[model samples]
Target: MKDKKKWIIGISACVLLMVSVFFVFNQGKSNEQVVTEYFELLKKKDYKQMYQMLNSKTVYTPTQKYFVEKYKEFYEEIDAKNIQIKILDEQDNVIEYLIYIDTLAGRITYRNKVGVKNEQIQFNKELIMDGYTDGCKIKITTYNPEKRGRILDRNGKVLAEDGKGYSVGLVKGKLNGENDYGQIAQYLETDVETLQKKMSASWINDDSFVPIKTVSEATKNDLINKNILGINGVKISTVSIRTYPYDKVASHIVGYVQNVNAEDLKKHKNEGYNSTSVIGRSGIEAAYEEKLRGITSGKIDLVDKNDKVIKELCHKEVKMSPQDITLTIDIDLQQSLYNEYQNDKSASVALNPKTGEVLALVSTPSYSNNDFVLGLSTDKWNALNNDVNQPLMSRYKQTYTPGSSMKPITAAIGLETKAIDPDKDLVAKDKWQKDSSWGNYYVTTLHAPSPNNLRNAITYSDNVYFARSALNIGKDNLFKYYKNLKIVEKIPFELALNKSQYINKNQKVSDQLIADSGYGQGQILMNPLQLASIYSAFVNNGSIYQPHIVQGQTKTWIKNVFSKETTKTIKEDLINVIVDENGTGHAIYHDHVILAGKTGTAEIKQSQSDTTGTELGWFTIMTTDEKQPILMTTVVEDVKNRGGSGYVVEHTKAPLDLYLSQVSD
Candidate 1:
């Protein structure tokens, strides 16, 4: 009985030992199986299976709120149905997965770096694992459509076109080897690295067959001679570039083009800008960017690895953009005026005194359109931008003190408001002074012993007379007239404006202040264009017309704020300023036409000095014939040699001579 019991115990112990060994080995195998199965599921994009296989302790439990909050933080579009899990690699302890997600635009793949853990994974802690896929990410390639538009003169002369040109493209799958890159770069007279970088930067993984650059005939011949293998990827297409036969003549007005950058893309993305686009940077190019940048056409060409074209998958027919715009400018007159101001630092604006058509607008210190077209280098761009005289600045848009130019407007306001009588005779007496609540500022006549009457005030540009007239008209009335004349604000025109402001004054109109205001002093501001237009109204029987740089546009007429009779009275008085022997503008007078005008010199203050700058000489005039009268205004700022009002008359003679000589026939 003892022996039998011992045998049973031995058997039981052996059975128990065998069971323990089997359980230990089975557990190890089960853990290995679980890891393998989980990785396989992740590779097959079966996230649910992988989640089920995860060790219970390390498994994550997520709430709807957690996902919602995470989605908001990343600005990501997350949908349970569209989430794809792709296992990138599984090594000793770490596993990487690419999670492809569906967005509003298309599929965006993300990378998740996950590690094995024994505890439950927190959703907030795992958020950092979501990152953009680097290796598996799709490389985006951008196509920039060519800018197609016509270059036309104000008269609608086509100077350029969107036509066919030779271009170079890479085959779909071809690598740009050193020899191929060298051959192309040498032909183009560019650096090999630069060419390679540009090619690499422009390469899009999805579409690699498109032309990289448009080359000239000379470059094409050179590439052919080199027997370049990948040269088969090169293509020829019609591209539009600005062409100017007149070159430097109209460069300032026509402007030029440049490559679009990152900032430009942000601002003008909706306006049809892409990665490889060109845009107008200045002149008519900038102003008419929308019109000039026509609709772009696209095509899909299948290319091989060697950049060899296989077939065109799809192509959208190119459509001709909108018709060219017509400008109301006279080309001949523009050339003539430009020629006139070529050597001098001056500007000329000629309008059809009857219709207000800008026949010619010319500013000196102009640049060549070709230089801009060919793509200016950094140094050249800097020189142009940093020029001291600011050649790039349009002088017609610059503002200046109107000086005696404001005299006629002041006189007309005085007479129309009945504040000062037309025939009121008062001696200018050379110097006039008045004390007011604000300390006195002296008003003087340009000529000594000046005539005091309204006629003499304009004729001699007598500050005292205007000052006394300002007192008569009152500050409120002066402001009203200026506003009515569009002097206080910007006038609507195609060109931009530098707005003028009236000097602020005390509530009560003071005698001395009124005097200063009357003489075009105190706080008066006027652009040369404004002064010219106002003078035109003064001489055109009170008919104020909007000044236009474009020709053939309708004349936008402003009602005669002053009646014809009142305008006639003002015109007669103003005639003395040019026709009278001692008149301020007498030097510019001619018997062939009745030239009535005024001369003014405004003092400018310089910085850090008690000394004042030389005067800005001014001349405003009107010429009348059987047809409607023509008006003109000229200004010469900081006259070097001839200072004061004399310089104004001297400069006025040139335009007057040209106008009379050209139009008298």
Candidate 2:
């Protein structure tokens, strides 16, 4: 009887334990179901269903419409395209889940908590949405405009750098009284009337905060901290101002930045560029913009019911920092040239004859690059556009009559066609007699010496001698030589080059035209770059090196324009032009460095309205150092003097001296 009673007690105890286990298991399952449903609805963007799952007795009670909008805003704030969730753990009425968000910035993960009681769901609603919950809140913070890449010269000197600044703006409707204007003006260091005028720009409206001026980064902070500028209506924020440290020195090569316009936005929208972003407008800045622009990223916050942010989470930076660019330019050389010629309307280019590495490219009358950095004022814009000197124009792209500079090419052609002998003497006359077919055409001689050889002809720039050589070479051979030399051929430059035109094949070529062309007259127009490039052949062993401003040498050579023997002979003759007593460039000749080059004086016709004809004086000089050859070309415009090439040679000495003393080192 005792054994049977013990068995019955054991069986009843086991049954009670089983019933307790069943009830607890069902309760936990219910909690998990409600928690899972809440998150699943949130993932589906079914904010209404998610709101319904929330206990109505909750303290964080936002209306259904508000709940939906709040979630919508949260989705927008996160910039997320997708949301994924997984059950992490469950204990009685408490549940935890891992939420993964796929955003434009990157993936974001969160460990979220949910509670259940009496099978009713309860949680901090603001964790996924934004609004005031008793203990729940959401906050969004942005850490935008990370550091941008720098633009550096080949020597690693900074050319473009980020400068700390701030935009000072006023809320259109925030100014309550006249005293406000005075307070703001004092902080801005301006008069009240001027400040008012600036604030009242057309772009500003009653609800707008229009920026008036940019101040130093420190100044912006000081005003905000002291509230000295009447913060009630004033707006200030840290900003990155792209500054060209050298300003006007390398303006054309380094380029400038401007606010992105509608066109730029439309073009680069897919590249993540916005209307407010600054874009490279010209030069290297425009060319390498993709590598120079900065990437944007920000932070997001979760707020509690008391309007307090509970957590701050940052989004991963979408793009790496902009890469700094290293250019092949020598800034010191560039600046020196700018200093010497900034006031003039002329252009100069220096390059390595063998490799075609441009040492310096100067186009004078340059405006300050900073003028375009922040924004260009209308008055300044109008001035740049109206200035007759056309300061912005790069003279390398503009063609002008090359004058006697073409004599060397003619000499090369004469040598190639076997029309003239280097050792043979040719008679140079005072002037060419008018031909019956040429009508009034007459070619004058600048310098005349009897029994002039090829070397003497080039040394004295004997026009009649070259004219006779061109006639001897005949029209077809001369034309063929021009084609071989690529005189009017379109140059392959990273920068655009204007296509040069030769005498039209359809037009009749008279004897005078051929003679005039021989001495670089009568419709012979070539830019300074083109002439410099052709002249490089003399030092490059009769091979033309494509001219380039960037670092890597193209090493492009047009070979066999003249025989090695002929090239040697022609090169020596050009050397005589600088060293010879009768040479046009003899005025600036120096014994320290052996110089070889030619001088030109082209008579440029003025507008038909003006009677005074101007002369375009040109000189191309080169160092004879075989290992370190430097070639320089200079042109002076509108010279009204008979000194001609001689005057140019004298005036060009200072810059050349500077270059030799400084750049050679």
Stretches off by above 4 angstroms in model 1 are 1-240, 244-252, 270-272, 294-320, 343-345, 436-440, 448-451, 504-511, 555-557, 606-610, 626-629, 643-665
**lDDT for position 35 in model 2:** 76
- Candidate 2 local lDDT, 1-665, one digit each (tens): 99999999999999999999987776664777777777678777888887877777772655888777777766755666577778889887778888777754566677877788866677575356433344444454434355557878768888887886778877778777556877776676566787678766788778787776676555567877877564577887667788887877887777888888899867653345565678888877887776777555545666665646666554556465577877766777777767766776667777778877777777778877876765554567889999998878876667778888899988888888799897788766787754666555566786877677898888889988888888888889988877777767887665566755557557788777788888887667777777887788887778888887656656765777777676777778888898988778887788788888899988877542445778888889888777557787877687656467666677567767876886567
Tens digit of per-residue lDDT, candidate 1, span 1-665: 99999999999999999999998766653323344454455345455544544455443446434433433333321212254566677565455666654432234455555555442221223332233221211112223345456666556765344444454555535553555766655554556676666666654553465555554445457766766444644444545445555655566666677668999977754344677577777766777766676544444333444545444333434353534645555566566656655655555566666777665566666777655654554567899999876677677777777777787788889888888876767654666676554434456564543335677666666777777888888878988988888776777777677887666545454566567778787778888777777766765678867877644565755768777877787778678777888776777778767767777787776531436566677666677663535565556656645656576566556655665666555
Predicted model with the maximum TM-score? 2
Candidate 2, 408: how far from true, in Å?
A: 0.7
Off by over 4 Å in 2: 1-148, 171-209, 215-238, 294-321, 504-507, 606-611
Candidate lDDT (C-alpha), each: 0.61, 0.74
* Model 2, TM vs. native: 0.68
